[model samples]
Target: MSVKNKVAIAGVGSSRVGKVPDRTGLGLAAEAAKRAVEDAGIGWDEIDGLLTAYSMTEKYFMLGSVMCEYLGVRPKYAASMVVGGATPGVMLNHAAMAIAAGECSTVLIVIGENRKTGQTRDEAVAALTTVGHPNFENPYGPPMPALYGLVAQRHMYEFGTTSEHLASVAVTARYHASLNPEAQMRTPITVDDVLDSKMIAEPLHLLDCCLISDAAGAIIVTSAERARQLTTSPVYLRGISEFHTHEHVSMAGDLTHTGAEVSGRAAYEMAGVVPGDFDMAMLYDCFTIVPLIELEELGFVARGEAGEFFAEGRARLGGQLPVNTHGGMLSHAHAGAAGGLFDIIEASRQLRGECGERQVNGAELAVVHVEGGVLSSHCTLVLSNSR
Candidate 1:
């Protein structure tokens, strides 16, 4: 059964992002959860279900139970979900389904990590590459940047997407971050600056990569009927869908054409809205090319034209459709799995008109899309303030 308008986000919260060496992953999660409960005007005891994304920096095996013990919360339903970067979106889907199935109500979703301060630079890089195929991709010793670089290179070759177009994405993200007080990198950058930045992987500059950060984010979801009693500005889950293409980049069927094509179509169909129905978007920006490719795959822009769409200032604030209004992973904090959770939080805040300087005007609808494991898994969510 379609979950359209059945589940609604009642509240959202996030911890101090960027670098925080003092707090543990569980500590961050607790802080964010408390804030979320407060934002929803509900007591901690009201949360019957809890869902958390697995922590890569932390060594805890049963992170869900560990977090429950740490927070003094005895949830009837709990789980530690792992789907790479797609965990947050996937978890949201599961939360909605569980609530619909009468398993529990008032679910709290949280994720956090201290990757920036907890791990050495080498360790951080190594963690990203561990997802590579053990036999074929791992033997080559390619880091995450190299994997995304290959995708960027392929897009350029096939669609005439230029380096300047990639730089535009970074520049836009930085500009948005400048308006976000919680963003990691707030300094506005130029396309030339991105072009001149040190190269990590060929054709992909350091600016093209997302930041490693220590951060946490949380969201509270409940049945739509219950959401109205909790908050007047509830963001309803209008559409949600997920698609898995492969585990590794090498196994992907097509480099440019991602599973977003299928997932986006399904989500739109479920929501009964097209791409034009969205007032804003929160496309995952793990790399510069990701959102550009997603825009095409999600039908936001014509294929082979996303590069121009971004380069022409159409994706920025006051443009046709503002994207990544909270700076996104490119300039915002990206704390492992929490990076995608931040996307959902930002979209909810935008719909609620809570964003101070970076708010999208009259944002009634938003589309949030995230991919994991070298674009191997995809999930798309369409959120709205109205039913």
Candidate 2:
């Protein structure tokens, strides 16, 4: 029943991100998938299972099948999940479980989207705002930023977290992105720069918001035993867990406390490790406040202490725990559900020592956490280089 070290990530790949105007979502996915298959040193026919995340800009109903056809891989098991940002993590869990259950082997998980260039700004804003409850929450016409702004406001009021603390998160992300050659916004930014940026919502500025970019990422997962034959350096899935709190932000029990508390605890328990065991973390940074809150919920810091944790440069590279080393959604590309998939890819690369400058030295263990639907659904995954 325990899936600990039962599955391992053999390879990972990503398409050119940020303002990709020429390729459709599926095209990006195919590119990433082909690269993943190649990275794994396996033929396309070896992929017995396929999983994909739904596209916000694309109108395809059976995206999994569509991607299968586009990639020319007839997978025995295929599914397309739509869980917002958490879809990638959820899909990884499914792939591991399916492989463990003997339903399939060599599963390929891919997601892609052209959110930046495929859709108009107004259209994208309109689509995101639809997450609000039609009867109660949608009538006021609150966009996604407004919903997260409420949480940031509440955290500030409850824990005395200041706007400067939130800005520190943005500053750290930009710093990491500056070292990444493929990042969309590589320009370094300071906390002062973040605070001075145009305010999108109260306590949240333009720099605090995650960028809208086109991207695609793919990862290949197989049984641990099979993984060793495929790649000498496979990232093992040490533990994985998911928790659902609510559908809409209004239905959330606590604004500051999220499902990450429950899922993170479960994942650590499953992995037989604690927060200190992790060398790095890739938390969902849809906004600056998200990772700050997640750091507390994931037991990296005590409640009301995450603000100082980031302010002290504890989450930056060469710090105690380098977080979002690939810059995350804040500065890296965030292409719909594919955004979170990048976290998994980054973790695997860090473990493999593939990241050149921004790599965390001797990264043996990592924790990747992602949430969807305004922090409604959460999935926590613990990955390690050693089984």
Candidate 3:
């Protein structure tokens, strides 16, 4: 039996990002879900599978059930996942499998959060900091920024990567954001601006981190056979893989190397494509150093060379391989864990030539990578315009 089954994304949608204090998390999700269902040209009754991700601010354990009731959907198969940042991409993999297994024909994947409006700054910090091991790590009270700062510090010490290299990632993402009207931070910035930003943690300035906002995104998955009957620009899921190396940052075998190394290899092998085959990459950029580390792990550039890759403008819009055309988490919007779903939506639109100014010319193949829990859990998806 072939490992790569035929599943395609028929439609994708996202709610208005940034601070929208008027809506709850469920409201944001419902808005995006409605758009996705409409875009797919399928009625709500056709959806037989539903998947959702956890929200730190929302105290709902049965989020899948709650979302179903809000959206008026009763799916035969329902699941809620909590894989941190990897939720979106991992959900895509699961939804695809369910469709391929004949368990469902249409699946809806939704994720969002009202982090900015729902939780105070202190509350948000406290909640995210708990991702670390309570007994061994959380007692020290290392915030997410500090944990990633340690990773950045280690990368610089071992590979001679400087703050300028990290700044380049921020600059590139901001440049892309300037083209995207829906992006949170649309103002273009330079490396000097990134360097001048306030320091959040050692080796990580404010710009080095992602923006916080209230946002939600969704996508509809169905069989490739069904997709042909729906949209003319269906984006096929050519390859997908996910893995977790550790639950906490302290448990990671190595701070510099993430699960992207393993997941990227598996996804590429299943897709029968190399890193160079992709026209663009929508990499998860929760922190600036993340993309550099993931680029190296995914074999797009040699270890320690990712610094030079970004410094030389290789990651810019018209560079060798455009990355994060929708500006990514850094400059776009990070609504709790739902940030990863934005990457998938942007990639699907790019494949369909829907990204106007930021579009990569002749883009047929693209890669979407999302990581969860301080770079512990990883998911990679290879999408193509042609089946």
Clashing pairs in 1: none
Q: How close is candidate 2 to the true structure, as a TM-score?
A: 0.99
lDDT of 2 by residue, 257-349 (tens): 999999999999999999988999999999999999999999999998998999999999999999899899999889888889999999999
Tell me how far the alpha carbon of residue 189 in candidate 2 is from the true structure, in angstroms, after superposition: 0.6
Give the RMSD in angstroms, all C-alphas superposed, for model 3. 1.0
Candidate 1, 1-387: lDDT as tens digits: 799999999999999988898888888888888899899999989999999988878899999898888888899999998888899999999999999999999899999898888899888877877778899999998988999999999999999999999999989999999999999999999999998999999899989989988999999999999999999899999999999989888988889999999999999999999999899989999999999999999999888899999999999999988889889999998988899999999999999999988988889999999988888889999999999
Residue 22 C-alpha lDDT in model 2: 90
lDDT (tens digit, per residue) of candidate 3 on 316-361: 8789988999999998999866899999999999999998998899
Off by over 4 Å in 2: none
* TM-score for each predicted model, relative to the true structure: 0.99, 0.99, 0.98
Cα lDDT for residue 33, candidate 3: 92
* CA lDDT of each prediction against the hidden true structure: 0.92, 0.93, 0.91
* Segments in model 1 whose C-alpha atoms lie over 4 Å from true places: none
lDDT of 3: 0.91
